[model samples]
Target: MGMSAGYELARRGFKTLLIDAFDPPHPNGSHHGEPRLIRHAYHGGEAYVRLALRADERWLELEAAAGEKLLERAGVLNMSDPDVYTFDGRLDDALKLGVRLEMLDVPEIVKRWPGVRLPDTYRAMYEPDAGYLYSERCVAAYKKLALKAGAELVTNTFVTDVKAENSIVSVRTKDDTFLAGHVVLSAGAWFKTLEPFIKLPIRAVRKSVAWFEPRGTLFDAGTFPGFTLGTKAGGYYGFPNIAGAGVKLGRHDTGVEWTPGEPFEPFGAYPEDEGYLRRTLETFLPDSAGKLLNGAACKYELTPDDNFIIDTHPHHSNVILAGGFSGHGFKFASVVGEIAADLIERRVSDQDLRLFSVARFAVAR
Candidate 1:
């Protein structure tokens, strides 16, 4: 979010400076994993549909400008037991926005992807236009573009303090301090450090993802699509094997509490890291659960409601606050950057941002 916002602010002729604790595209934050799902048919709410459509346009534009592939049109399949899945808003939003979605029965799902083995009670929704984004590459692309657009980037530095008073925003590190007319605080899990400036009810949670060697080409990207499955056990999401990277899988709900400054434990530090994923794979995608290829751990900054916070400070309006994205925010990086720029420049965004306001949280101070 910081990288995207920096690029937009710089390209729009605003003197911009982006500060980070570590070099981006690194594994310290949530955007490090290889691929992030990008689906337009949102189960969260209808408000996200328009932002997602705009983000898709911006991502394609970035791909064209960078001369590289940042997004893959592999499609996305969402499957669940009829009794467990209750988010009908996904279909409603898709239909209203003219998104190409197909409702698939058990037989149709099995016929299309022979590798999948779901029970007769399972149903699926397929979005032909949805896909995944190359997360690290997207950050690198934005970093390059932001620099080329004359934005100064200070990497490998920690911001110790941020003070906004008398219409001037001051950011301080261990060695020096910088001042700007406005500032965007898009810190991911490290948001707790800035509580002195403004308080928000956010917590960091540790999550893990693993890649498994597939049995055959049945789970390859060409034949299979990115998918999400929900059952009585838990919710899981995965990607088909791409360029021999293996089938990537991750659980969406339930994670251990993580501290902001502590080093993230390795993927196998806990048994459930691999155990739960293997169990999920065996139940739904047995063909792709041959062997564990690789694993990674990341952090999710979650709000009380698992929604995002994209609003200006309650008292210090010049200090924009954007965090608490939960687990689903990478695909919206492009438009969120644009909205941040809009907020700084015009004090308003073209999109309806009431859903992400700081006022929504009772604990926000």
Candidate 2:
């Protein structure tokens, strides 16, 4: 998010300065694990569909600018019980925004795509336009663009303090201090670093992603599509074998909280902590879940409502706060980049962002 925003701002001639604790393509952040799902039908809420629509356009723009295939239109399959809340709102939002999508039943899904298996109650929603984003490459591309646009980029430099004085936002790094006309606080999972200054009610949850070799031909691109299955327990999402290693699987419910900049340590409390996740392959996705090949940790800065907060600081208009993407925000980096830049440039977005404002948290509009 920071990289995209910084690059967009610089491209728009903002005299931007993009700083990060680590260099570009760092794996310590969320833009890792090969691919991120980009679904048009947002299950969280309908309002997100608006942001996602803009995101689609910006992603294409970035793809064209980078001269690389950043987004793959492999389509996304959503599976859940009829009672379970899925991207039903995504359909409404996409229809309202003129995005092409479809909702399918079990037979229709099975007939169209024979690789997946669901319970009798499970239904599906398919979005042909939704697919996957090449996260790491996109980040590198944005950073490159930002640098080419004459934006100063400093890496391996941690921000220690932020002092805003009536619109002159100043950021203090470990070694030096710099000031800007406006500041965008887009620190990802490390958003807690600004707690003393912003007092945001966000929590960083340590999450993991696991890759499993396919059992049979189920992992083929013709059969399996990137999908999110909503079980009675929670949501489990996966990607096809885009990287040739295997199918990528991740859980949405299991995560631990840690302070910003803290070293990550794996928990070995429950067998399921490691074993159970792998065992799920034997039960749920027997064909796809074979040997647990690799797993790595990422972080999610979550809000109570599991939505994002993308607005200015309630007390500090000069300092824009654009974090708390919940867990599924990487797909919107393109649009969010433009939105952050627009907010800084005092331009208006066609999408209504009132639902994402800090005022909703009682910070005073």
Candidate 3:
């Protein structure tokens, strides 16, 4: 998101300087895995659905600008307990926005991809315009575009503090002090450490993604689709095999409370996580659970309500806080980037950012 914003700002002739603690496309942050789901029948709200649609448009714009493919068109199948209240507003938003979707019973879903079996009462929402985004590739693309647009790219430089005084924004790094009319804080997990003086409502939690060898062609790209399943027990999501590698699965909840300095070990390094993945795969998709492959961990900077915090600093108007994001924020990077640039350039946001404001936390300045 930081790079996307920088690219947009530079494209609009803003003298933008993007700083990062580590060079991107590294395995230290949240968006490191192979693919992330992009769906229009969203679980957040109508405003998020609108943002996702705009993001989809921006993704196409990037593909055209970069002259290559980034998003794949594999449909997403959302299987959940029909009685759960999670999809209540989601259904209304999808219908109101005219997002193309279909309702399928357990039998129909199993018939579509016979590797997975489900209870007779479960329901599915199949979104046709949904698929996966090659995550790290996306970062590389935005970095290229930003550099091409004349944005100063500074990697391997860590930010120490960001303070604003007398309507002037100053960013202090380890060895340098830089000034700007506006500063954006896109440091993912390190944002907590950078602004420890302010009591923000963000927590850095570690999550895992597991992979499994496919038993047969039923779970391959040709027949199967990317899937999300939820029950009273828990929920799991997975993608089809990429280049004959293997299928990928991830649980939506945070595993262990993570700090910034800890190592990002492979997921199965802990026996409990491996056991959890095994049980989840054995119960959900028995046929697809052929062999237990490897897994890895990542970070999610969570907000109190799982929405984003895209508002300006409560004490300083020249600083913007683009944190929280939940775990599903990667798909909206393009639109959020545009929003960041809009906030920095126009002094007002183009999108309604009330749901993701820092005022919800009510912190003491």
Candidate 4:
């Protein structure tokens, strides 16, 4: 979100300076996963569909500007549990938004994705245009464009303090203190690092991803679609074997609670993570579970209700806060970037963002 926001702001003729605690596209952040799924099912809420629609456009624009294929058009298969929340609003939004999506039954899913085996309680929503984003390439493209647009990027600079007062925001680093007319805090898991200064209902938790070599062409990208499923155990998501590398799988639920100070412990360090994936495959994609090629651990910053927060700080209007994506936000990064820039410019966005306000959490607290 920070990279995309900096790029947009710089493109809008704002003198932008993007500073990262570590050089971006590194393995440390949520963005380091092999690829992130971008779909419009938007079970998060219908409020997100508009932003997702805009983000799809923005991603296309970025791809055209960068002249690189950043997004894949592989379809998405949303496998939901009828025993749980049955009406996934995406069914309604698909028609309203003119998105070409179809509802698939258990048999249809099994027919479409030969490797997937699900119970009768599961149904699927298929969106043809939904796909995956090559995450690292996206950061590189945004960085290149932002730099070309006259934005300065400083990496490996840890932020020590962020002070917003009297129309000016001061950000202190280990080496220097910088002041700006406004600030956008898009800090991910480390959002708590801001401390009592910014109280948010966010928790940083460990998450895992595992890659498995497919047994046959049955699980390759050309024939299979990226999918998310609600099993009896929990929710699981995965991508097809793109370029024959392997099938990638992950879980949505949080792992162990983590903090910035002691964050780098690998997810696989907990043997249960691997055991869970093995069970997930043995039950769902039995044939595709050939060999575990590799695994990775990352952090997920979450909110209690799993909704996001995108609003101005309660007391400081000049300080905009953008965090709490709750494991499902990269697809909206483009639109969020535009909204962040719009907030900084003090302009009303055509799309409503009231659902993401900070006050909602405060009232609940």
Candidate 5:
């Protein structure tokens, strides 16, 4: 988010300076994972769908600007029991938004992807245009663009303090202090570090994802599609094997609460890290449930309601806050950056950002 926002601000002729705790595209942050799903027929609501559509357009523009491929149109398959609200919500959004969605029965799902083994009662929604994004590459692209657009980047610097007063925004590091007319706080999991200035209820949760060796081409990207499955255990999402990267999988719910400054435990820290993914794969994608290639652990900055916080500080309107993405925010980075720049420059956005206001939460003060 910070990289994208920095790029937008710099390109738009703002004297922008981006500070990062570590060189981006590193494993420490949530954006390190190789693939992030991008679905337009959103289960969340119309607001998300609108933002997603705009984001899709922006990603293409970025790709053109960078002269590299950052998004893959591998398509996405959403599988769930008929009674699951997630499935209903996605279908409802598709119908109302005119998104191209194909409702698939168990037979069609099996016929289309022989590897996916769902129960007879399960249904599937296939979005042919939805796909996955190359997360690290997207960050790198934005970083390069930001620099080319004349933005100064300070990497591997920890921001110790942030203050907004008298229409001036002050950001301090251990070595130096800088002041500007406005500040965009996009600290990700470390967002709580600024709680003293911008009070909000947020926490960092440790989550794990893994890649499994597939049995054959059945789960390859050309044949299979990116998928989300709802089962008795929980919601699981995955990407098909792309360029022999293996089948990537992760659980969408339930992660350990982690402190902001502590070392994040690796993927095998808990038995369920691999165990749960293995079980989920065995049940839904039996063919792709081969040996485990590798795993990674990242953080999710979650709000109480799992919605994003994209509003300015309650008292300090110049300090824009963008975090608490929960787990599903990577695809929106492009538009979020635009919105951040919009708020900073115009103090308003054409997009309806009321859904992500800081006022929605009972702030901690």
Candidate 6:
């Protein structure tokens, strides 16, 4: 996400400098997974539909520029009970916005996609436009482009403080100081620690991802589209083996609490967390859960309402903050990069950012 913003800024001729505490595409940060779900019919809200739509174009543009496949057109199936949040305002709004989608009964979903079984009561909304994003590849591409665009790339640099005076923003690292017309805090989970801090309603929770060998052709890409399971007992979401290792499954809410610098090793794959995911798979599609291959841990910067905080600091206008994505923000990284660029350029975007403003959190904007 950092590289996305940085590259966009550099591309816009901002003399940008991209800094990272840890080298990206590395497990030290949140975005390490092979694929992240990209669904336009967002369960979060309809306001995100336009942003998601714009992001799709950016993804294709990045893919073309990188000369590599960064997004898969596998489609996405949002399975849920009729009354669940996924089917209500979120899907309804997408429909109103002219997003293409198909409603499916349990039998229809199961019959059409023989990879898994759906309960009789389960319903689904299939977005043929939805698919998966190659997170690691995208970050790598962004970093490469940023450097090629003459943006200074600094890695292993620890940003200790950010101070704004008048309209100038000074970013101080452990070893050097740099100045910029504006500062963007796309620092992911660590944004809470920055100076002149805008108290983010973000909780960094440890999340785990597991891979399982397919029982049969059920996990084949031709049959299994990327899917989000919205069951009664919470849910899990994943993609097929397009990028190739095995099928991936991640529990949305089944994460452990951990702070920065804490060891994620001991906490990942805890029995209960695994049990919850395993139980869900067992109930819905046992064949897909037979053999677990590998698992790893990541973090989610969750907001109270699970929305993002993408706005300038109320007290410190020079510092722009973008964090608290819950877990579904990666797919929108493309448009978000442009949004951050706009903020840095001090342009008022036609897109309404009220839902993501810092003022929404009662932070005196």
Considering every candidate listed, which one attains the maximal TM-score? 1
| Cα lDDT of model 2 by residue, 58-145, tens digit | 8999989989989888888888877766655566767876778777877887777666677767887788888988889999899888
Model 3 lDDT tens row, 51-102 = 8889999999998898888999899999988775346688789889888988
lDDT of each: 0.92, 0.79, 0.82, 0.84, 0.90, 0.79
lDDT of 5 by residue, 294-318 (tens): 8999988889888899998888888
- Model 3 scores worst on lDDT over the 10 consecutive residues at 190-199
Taking every candidate in turn, the Cα RMSD to the unseen true structure, in Å, is: 0.9, 2.1, 1.6, 1.6, 1.1, 1.8
What tens-digit string does per-residue lDDT give for candidate 4 at 1-365? 99999999999999899989999878877888668889876765668777788889999999999999999989888887888646456678656777778888888788777788888778788889999898889988999999999999989988878888788989989999988997888889988888666888798988898888888799888788888877667888899998867888899975889888884787568887788887888888888787888788888899888888898888888888889885788888888888999988865676688888899886321
* Model 4 quality (TM-score): 0.96
Q: Report how far off residue 112 is in candidate 2 (Å).
A: 3.3
- Where model 5 places Cα greater than 4 Å from the true spot, the runs are none
TM per candidate: 0.98, 0.94, 0.96, 0.96, 0.98, 0.95
* Candidate 1: tens digits of C-alpha lDDT, residues 3-54: 9999999999999999999998899999987999999998667789888999
- For lDDT, the strongest prediction is 1
Clashing pairs in 6: none
Off by over 4 Å in 2: 44-46, 266-270, 363-365
* lDDT of model 3 at position 62: 91
lDDT of 4 at 231: 66
Q: Of the candidates numbered 1 and 5, which has the greater lDDT value?
A: 1
4 versus 6: better lDDT goes to? 4
lDDT of 6 by residue, 244-286 (tens): 4777888787577767667666434478646666677777777
What shift in Å separates residue 209 of candidate 2 from its native position after superposition?
0.9
